[model samples]
Target: MIIPDWLSDLHFAFSHRGDGQMSFKHADKDVVLESRNRFFHDKGLNLDSVVTGELAHGAEVALVTEADAGRGARDRNWIEGIDGLVTDKPGILLMTTHADCAPLVIYDKAHKILGQAHAGWRGLASGLIESLVGRLKSLNGTGPSELHAWIGPTIRACCYEVDRDVADRFPDHCRFLAGESIRLDLTMFVHRELWRLGLNPDYVTDSNVCTSCNPEFSSYRRDGLNTQAMACITGIPE
Candidate 1:
């Protein structure tokens, strides 16, 4: 698995090799599909299970249990409207897709509970991060201090401009770019949310890669409607 330089020592894993590449694996496939196939083909995963949602930018979190195993690379009968997924089952990869939205991954090492959340501005404002953490705690008795978090690549403050209406939705503590056009720092907002949830700042790692600034990444802000998203996935090795 390719680990980006900004997220060193987090122990949580994700792929970064597709950077600057325009192959079918990165361009055409959803992040979950690409990650599942890579893990399977590389002989790193024993279970082929993957779960995601319709991602309506809400705070809903779906639980992936043993019954949901081996569902990866298969079409579902109905899409669940959720922004986060959590599981303790080994080989059951929990994934969330993002183009410019920050992909948040959390792992509770003691309990082996892993979680992935999609945090766009709307999701962030809706308290998705807190919802995921609360669910993890309830399901696995995992506390904020015991969990490790990784914030993935997304639209950075340099390119994520927001109007007053959107900016007002966030807490006053969030950082913002100055000027007539107000750009917000989403990664910082996520970091603040982590802190608010009682997770130590030291336990959180930020990718710091701006999708809008880097041509290697897919960016809705840059490509408009044509942006292809990347996936951030996590699970216990079976």
Candidate 2:
């Protein structure tokens, strides 16, 4: 429950600790459920107040109003075909899962609107961050300057090597390296996107922890297909 100082004002949660119930340490279902429950209880929210699903690594954004709050997490409904969630509703948590992929959490302080995104190579190449910011602006009339962003733990360029095809998908600005073997700085790319959207550079924070490089955190690129994922959750207090 002790969020990093960078995002303290934003009412958010993240885990370096792997969940035990989720099969994979990073994706332990039982651990995630327990964490969600604890988050809701500690925040004085109902179990039905958290919203999340099986992220598809796409650009599809789910608009969560009060009605949809907590449905997926509590009901165990399949959140198929979606990669992001946004809401202005209080007490409703927006969550996303990741191992090496970065979890980007955005908040509009003035409007109390928050967004959670799953940004991997595909989602980042697809401009999911821009789309999510645009959606938040449309829903709450809050501009990018009013938003605060946090980029969570992910595979850093030092440890993340991609093929040319996958690396080339990003624009020149987003690409950190290019050669027979390429390294992509996903956290930096997301930060660049936030700046492009007009959010103040000072307001953005990066965890700077690389999953692939750190043994304490889970890493699919290092651990292979069976690695677990960490969940990043954020919301407004009731």
What CA root-mean-square deviation does each model show from the true structure?
4.2, 3.2
Give per-model TM-scores.
Answer: 0.82, 0.85
User: Candidate 2: minimum summed lDDT over ten consecutive residues — where?
Assistant: 17-26
Per-structure clash totals for the candidates: 0, 9
Candidate 2 global lDDT: 0.73
Local error of candidate 2 at residue 182 (angstroms):
1.2
For model 2, give the RMSD to the true fold.
3.2
lDDT of each: 0.70, 0.73
lDDT of model 2 at position 154:
84
Tens digits of lDDT, candidate 1, 156-225:
8888888899989977766565777887887888888888888989778777788888877778789765
Stretches of candidate 1 above 4 Å error? 1-47, 70-72, 76-79, 175-177
